[model samples]
Target: MLEDLAFPIERLGQAVTDVQLLFEKYKYENGIIFGHAKDGNLHFVISQGFFTKEDIDRFEHFNQDLFDLVLNKYDGALKAEHSTGRAVSAFVEKEWGPAAYRVMKRLKNVIDPANLLNPGIIITEDKQAHVHDLKVMPVVEEEVDKCIECGYCEQSCPSRDLTLTPRRRIVIRRAIKRMEDTGDRAGRKALLKDYRYDGMETGAVDGMCGELPGEH
Candidate 1:
C-alpha cells in the first residue's frame, strides 16, 4: 500500500492543477487518492491481487509507466510521505541514478554491512525484490474491503471528534469478520455486542460521508 509515489504539482500534468483531474488523466481508478495538495503530496492505494506472478508482473509494468511519468518526465520522487520499503526499494537507484545510488549503497555498507536494520528497505542490489514473494491479502466476506485504510476519510469524520473514526469502523468490521471466519464465536459475539452501540447505532458507520456522519 505504501508503494504509491509522489509528484510535484506542476509535474502532475501540463495543464491540470486539480488533483482530481490529475487522477483522471493518470487514472488511479482502483485507488482512493487524497492528501495535502498544498504540500504537493498525495497518498493512494492500488488494491491488487498479489498472489500470482501475473499480478506481480502487472505491478511491475505499472511501475515502469509510473517511473517514466515521475522520474523521467517530471523529476518527481519515487517516494512521497511513505518510505521506500520492500515495495519500491527496487526503484530507489532509478530515482537517484547510478552514481548517487552507488554512494547510497556505500553508505549503507559502511554502516550496516550485515543488513540488520530494515533490510531490503533501501540501497538494495536485488532487481526483483519489489515483486518477490508479495504478500497476499486473505479473503474476507464483508464489504469492509471498500475502505482502503488511507486515512483520507478520517480527518473530516465528525465522530472522530466525538465517538470513533471511519477507518476504525472498518477495522472493527474486519476484526469481527476474522473472528467469524476463524469460528471464534465468543470473540465475534463480544465484538459485535460492543460495536452494536457506536459502530452500528452512531455516525461512525454511516459510510463516512462528507456531511455529518449520521445524516445519511
Candidate 2:
C-alpha cells in the first residue's frame, strides 16, 4: 500500500537527493538527521550556532531550492504528510503553480474570506506574515497552565516502548500555548492541527486527545 500511494521508490530517491543537497549546502557541522526516505520526508536539527538571522535567510533559500529540485524535479507534491502552514505555505505556489494555487485561493475566499477561520496559513496575501501571527486556537496555553512540567507524562508515555520519545508532544503543546497568548489565532490553529485535532473537546485537558462531540 505504501509503495502504491505516495511512498514509491521514485519519491524516496528524490527525498534522498534533497537531504544530500541540504547537507552539502550547509556543510552539516552538527545536527540530528532523521526522517522516512520511504515517504520522502526528512527532518534536521542543527546547533544554535546555525540559527542566526542570516542563517535563517540562507535556510529559507535552501528550502526553496530544495523544494524546487525535489517537487518539480520528481513531480511530487511539496507536502505529502504535513499540511502546508505558515512556515511552508508561502512556497505552495512555486510547487503547485499559479493555476492550482488560484483555485485554492478562491476556495479559501469563499469558505473563510473573513480570514477569521485561520488566517495567514495555506493562503495569505501578505508575504511578510511572521510565524507568530498565524495562531488559530489556544488549546496549548490551557494545557501548559495545568501541567507542572514535572516530566511525569514523559516517563509514562509508551512511545519509549518503541525506542521513541514523547518530549516533542509536550513541547508542541507549550509552544502553541505561547503563540495563542500572543493573539495569533492562525498560528494557534496551525499548531493545533499539527497535533491531529480539529479542536479541543469541551472540558478536555488541552493536550489530551478526545473525540469532538458528534465526531464519533
Candidate 3:
C-alpha cells in the first residue's frame, strides 16, 4: 500500500462485486489489486502509458468502459474515494445524473466564480478533459517500472531526512540505468559512485523497500 503511494499512480479505484469481477473480463497484467476485501472496496494500480493520442484514446475508452461496467452495468460507484480528479471527473455527471451535477456546478460557480481554487479538480466542465493531459510512464525496470512517479511514498519514508527520498532514489536510478544502457561506462560509473552513498546507502530505511510483496 505504501509502495503504491510512493510511486506515480495513474489509475483509479474500482469497487466491484469482487476483484474477480474485474478479472472476469480483462487481464490486468501490469497492475495489482489490494484493499479492504471484507468490506467490498478494492484498490488496484495499473500503470498507464499515455504517450500518444491513440494511447490516451485507448485509456479514455477503457475509462468509459470501466464507468459503464461499474456505473451503468453493475450499479457501482465511480469513486470509492471522495475526489475524482480529471481521470474520473469526466464521469461525475454520469455518476450523479444530470440534475445533481448541475447543482454541483451551480454550487461551484457560487463559491468560486472565478475558479481560483483547483482549476481542473473535482467537477471539470471540459467534454474531452480525460483525454487531455494524461501522464505517461517511461520504460524502466520492472522493480520500479510500474511506478507512475506520483511521490506519495515520500511522506512516510523513514530515511526522508537522512539523505535522499524514495522518489529521488528512483529518479537517480533511472538516470544510472539510462547511462548503462547507452554504454556510457564513465557516466554510469560516476552516477553509481554518487548513488552508492546518496541513493543506495542513505535511502534505505532499515531495508524498507526490501519488504515488498513476495520478496525474500
Candidate 4:
C-alpha cells in the first residue's frame, strides 16, 4: 500500500523517522520511503498482503496505527498527493474535524442527492470499506509479477496505437493468470485466443520497452 503522508514542512525529518519506525513495528522492514521533502509529503510503499483473515486484521491494525500517528500525533494528512479515496475515506471526518466534515457531507448531499458521484469513495459510512474489495495480486511470472502497473512503458512502446500497449499486455497476462488460478478455463482460453493477435502480432518484440530507462 502506497500512501502519501503530509506533515508540517519543518517536521519532515521527524515525520519520516516516525513513519520508518512505525513500519518496523508492523514488521514491514523493506518498506520503500520517498517523496517531496520540501512539501513535507512522504510517500511510503509497504508490501501488504490480504490473503487471509490474519493478514486482513494485521492490515486493519496497521492502518489504524498509521492514521493515529499521522493525524493525532503529527497533525498530518493521509492523502497528500491524491484524493481521499476508499483507502482513507473513513478518516476524512477525523482529519477535517466534525464541523468541517458535516459541511462537506451536506455539500456532497446537496450536489449529488442520489449519491451517484463516486459514492462511498471520498466520504463513506463504512469504516472497514477500505479493506473490502481489496485487489489480489496474482503471481503470474517473475518478470510480470514485478510490474507496478505504471504506464511509463506505454508511451515508448511501438504497439501503442496498433493494439494493446506494454502495460495492457501485462494487465491481460495478469488477468489470465488469475483466471487460471480460479479454474476459469473458458475465460482464460478466450483471453489467450485474443492475446495471440493483439498481444503478440501487434506487439513490438524489438526490446523497445526495455530500452527505456526503467524496467518494462
Best by TM-score: 4
Give residue 4's lDDT in candidate 1 (0 to 100).
52
Clashes of 1: 0
What TM-score, over all chains together, does every model reach? 0.61, 0.53, 0.62, 0.86
Candidate 4 per-residue C-alpha lDDT over 1-216 given as tens digits, one digit per residue, 9 for 90 to 100: 878789999888988888888888889987989999888898988876788998888788889999999999889888888767788888888899999989999999999999999989977888788799887888766677677775788788777888988788888887887887899989988887887788766768843223211114
Q: In angstroms, how far off is 96's CA in candidate 1?
A: 0.6
Residue pairs clashing, model 1: none
lDDT of 2 by residue, 27-65 (tens): 654545555665655555443223357755665566666
Task: Give me the displacement of residue 186 in model 1, in angstroms.
Answer: 20
How do all the candidates rank in terms of TM-score, highest first? 4, 3, 1, 2
Residue 215 of model 3, lDDT score = 19
lDDT of 1 by residue, 87-188 (tens): 678888888889999889889989988889887788676888877766544454345566667688788887777666878776776776667667988988
lDDT of 2: 0.55
- Summarize candidate 3's per-residue lDDT along 145-206 as a digit string, tens digits: 65556688788777888777777777766676666667878987776677667765665664
Task: Provide the overall lDDT of each model, using Cα atoms, as 2-decimal numbers.
Answer: 0.66, 0.55, 0.61, 0.81
- Give the local distance difference test score of model 3: 0.61
